[model samples]
Target: MAEEKFPINIWVNEERYEKLQTAGLADMCEEMLAGLKVIRVYANSAQRDKILQVFPTAKFDSATTKSIELLPREVKDAIFGKVVEKRSIDILEEFLGQY
Candidate 1:
């Protein structure tokens, strides 16, 4: 399928912005160049475990794992009932920690 491009605004350090402009492969340099700041990822235990299987280096807090484990199975089922049809959520992850 053909990919779609959309505009997004972001903020970043001037140096990083210049680097992205130099690389030139990114479709949305302005958006990518922005947010040179840290990007936080949140996930629960079972989800974290699956991600770690693929990304062993991913950093996460133990508290988040515990909290996700505490969520009632029934509640999770209801909230994610329709999402199950998608099979998976390949949510965006920052690549090479690039800003």
Candidate 2:
């Protein structure tokens, strides 16, 4: 089975492109660019690079960069909240065990 690929259209500037390059997600960024007009789906990272090679001038938006930056924190917070809740339960169990 092939991995699922989501198509997204976004505008990107040089700063955001640089950030993508720095994070080694340039291929992913390129995939977004290729998705703008092409119906082609990228099945792997290699395909993303190929799409970028074909569409080197694809654009990116700052909002996309901002959202990407924020996504990790949002995910982390959600996971951290669950972890803390679990730890609290464990601590309560330990306390009750002592009694």
Candidate 3:
């Protein structure tokens, strides 16, 4: 068995921000980095982390010291919606064609 780990940082969207204030910087980072999709800071944050929208795995690169935009929930939800809408259909189609 082996132990694996990665580091990550998360922030909020400013412009056009309908962002929920989940947890503060520290708590957000902790939960977001740990691969938790929902973030409720101080047990009372209206904000939600969009992490699960893309990476349901909740895994991220905390170590990369690069400026990464905290993707908006709207954008993520839209993308997820599009993909999910077709995923089952695509899977069935592919399986049927394999015969």
Candidate 4:
């Protein structure tokens, strides 16, 4: 069976959106809420496990989209930066590798 994927949402502002567009990743924004753009990066089971291990404060928000929530702003910004640099949403494994 395919593994369940957990989401890590990165909220985008105009500056971040411009960077995403330049990185050719603009189409990755799947949802926009209350004038904010959201890009949901998926994490497979192993990567999700790594994230939980690395960030003890993080938890899955099952009440919503099963997203890995409560991440600090700096961490989210770092993740977003990595996404733009790599021009891909498949960044959880590599990003977690730094921890």
- Highest TM-score: give the candidate number: 4
Q: How accurate is candidate 2 locally (lDDT)?
A: 0.33
Off by over 4 Å in 3: 1-68, 88-99
The digit string of per-residue lDDT tens for model 1 on 1-99 reads: 543221111222454345434555233332323444311223434455544454454433345332223223343342232122322222222221221
TM agreement with the true structure for every prediction: 0.25, 0.24, 0.24, 0.83
Determine which window of 10 residues in candidate 3 has minimal summed lDDT. 39-48
How well is each residue in 41-74 modelled by candidate 4, as lDDT tens digits?
8998788878877888989887967889878878
* Residue pairs clashing, model 1: 11-35
TM-score of 2: 0.24
User: Given candidate 1, what's the lDDT at residue 25?
Assistant: 22
Query: What's the lDDT of the predicted structure labeled candidate 4?
Result: 0.84
In candidate 1, which residue ranges exceed 4 Å CA deviation? Answer: 1-36, 59-99
Residue 99's lDDT within candidate 1 is: 17
Best candidate according to lDDT: 4
Give the least accurate 10-residue stretch of model 4, judged by summed lDDT. 28-37
Cα miss at 52, model 3 (Å)? 20
Q: In candidate 2, how many clashes are counted?
A: 5
